[model samples]
Target: MKKVICFLAVLITFVAAFQLFRQKEGVENESYTINLRHNKSYHDETDELIYKGLLWSFSQVGATLPKKTTARGIEKVTDTLWRIDVSKLGFRPVVLEKWRRIIAAAKNTQEYHLYGSIMLNRFVICSIYASNHYYEMVQAPKTYSEFLHPSVNASSKAEYAVEISSVSKGERLIRMDTTVEAITAQQFIAVEGSGHFSQGNFKEELFELIDMMPNGQLRYLIYSHNGRLVNASPNSYGDAGKPAKCMWCHESYLLDNFMSTPNIKGYLNYEQFVSLNKRNNDKLIKYRKQLSTEINYENKKDHELAEIMYISYMEPSAETLAFEWHLSIEEIRRHLAKLRTHQHHEFPFLGQLYDRHEVDKLAPHKSVPIPKSIREPNDDEPNLLGAN
Candidate 1:
């Protein structure tokens, strides 16, 4: 009976000891997880994990294939900039196969040059215009009528130029604003001579030309000789430097529409495009008038005029400008003093000049969050290449 009791006691003791051991292990695991969650090191760790997976995938795919030269890795150009040669992995059959449908559907095959980048968790395939092709497109049109309208003649010799760029996020390929510049006096003449100075349809043909480009979203900016931003497409105010009225549409509906359909003609009907743009323009004029009334309503003439001028030219955040000019927050605030109108208003004159060191500190965390409705189809899914 005593031996039986002893055996029972030993068994109970063994069970208790095992429970304590497990509890200790669980506590230690919880601590480790909490530390990981709090620390910024997780970002770097995540990036490294993704990078390793990308490298392995590239190796596996590239091994069985031809030993062709391609852009395999990134080279740090500056402290803030890293340039990845896309041509290496960009032309690979494996990579191209993923985008076979998009490539097949593209209208102007000659315009696009494939570019690739391995981002945080996913690899991106960009379809940007080839450098030579872009140059050809931007060349001063042979006929006076072909030049972009509303030209600016500068003292120095100016050239007509256009630049287009795109980047992929999820399933959507977001095209950056196409910029058209007229730098020289002759270029200005060519631009103005292109079309009649009509109110509604001033640069209709030029707009049409831009629309015809592959994946073109009808967003463009025309800059004057002295680097003044003069015109923007979907411009509601018809005034240079004024914000577009269709900003929300561009950010949401248009983006979603293009991603879903991709084919320009099928999604964006010409008649609707013209009608919507014109409607926005009318709304913009009314908006500007209202804005003007608000600005003038305060009745502080000198102070208000100065504030308007500052807003028109500087276009910087109050904090940023203060830092740049070495002014105190109070002093900068006083300089930009105006009647409070909006709850979360940004000071109008905050400019974009940034020191390299400041820019570097901010760049890593700086991401533009795309609306969920316009997000890539599989953006929420775990990256297969990066999965353990």
Candidate 2:
């Protein structure tokens, strides 16, 4: 009788442990708490080696690493989970690829390959190479005044001012680089200025571009004076590449308010400034009107231009789907397992992500309350422009 009782107790304990493990397997591997700042930036040889290795790893799978690839911020949260500061790397326009070694240095090459297989799929790398094709096709002007129409003599400044400036230190001198009727991509450049608007002492160190797409839609692009694309500029408010931070201020087109240029002798009068704004705005409206379907601004706002290009492609986790549809995590898991999906562990603790277009089809019939356990952070969390 004593032996039977001991055996029964052992069997019950084993069953309970198995049940607990199964439950955890159905959910995420682990939970994470993320902080939005990078504790360190790469500076030494070791850092460079790590960074280059990460670049090589990404290149192996034909993935275009994120544009900003210098700052390093990866933290092990628990034994099974890790968290990355996407906010810091993105706004600082710094490298978020510092963690490649963590997977590359796995137990063996096969495990490393497995990690790459899961993370480097088309859906996962979409954000990295979203704008590659378009950017590659663009023969950017050596100078904004070169390829754009109605070229300004680099020194010209528009008679416009705003109460809250975009650039960090100096005033912003607006210039329309294209003609109203130009068939090519319309262009605008905002340069840094100091003192009065008319006698604008423009600096070429920082600049912003508003380039028109072939479809007549507008996309913001940022560049340093050197012509290389930077994440943000001291001359403009838009931080993320493609100026992801600038979208809220510029909803569909230009701002309606046209403040008077400073009382400088050569500056355009308020009336002339207003007229120029109207002309530019009119061009924007005309181009946009050519579209039959409504533009999806939310999608645009959620990602940088590079990521926006591959918006349709994503590897979503159960939590991500649950948060997206305002459904319980369990329901999301139930629906996900029923679909054909290739599961892989995504970076920074996006565990068990599904690689399938069928995930997009699992829409909730009714609004379900999203549990607080699975809330997501804003991809483009606000940071002080040029603070880096």
The best candidate in terms of lDDT: 2
Off by over 4 Å in 2: 1-168, 177-179, 183-185, 193-202, 235-242, 256-261, 292-388
Residue-by-residue lDDT tens digits, candidate 2, 144-221:
444445544446445344323433355565556433465234566665434534445544455677766544444555
Please tell me which predicted candidate would have the highest TM-score against the true structure. 2
- Residue-level error in angstroms, candidate 1, position 362: 26
lDDT score, candidate 2: 0.40
Q: Which 10 consecutive positions of candidate 1 have the poorest summed lDDT?
A: 32-41
Model 2 Cα shift for residue 359 (angstroms): 22
Q: What TM-score fits each model? A: 0.21, 0.41
lDDT of 1 by residue, 54-156 (tens): 3322222221111243223323333322333333332344434322322232312221122111111111211111111111222313332344444322332
- TM-score of candidate 1 against the unseen true structure: 0.21
Candidate 2 pairs with clashing backbones: 68-94, 68-95, 69-95, 70-95
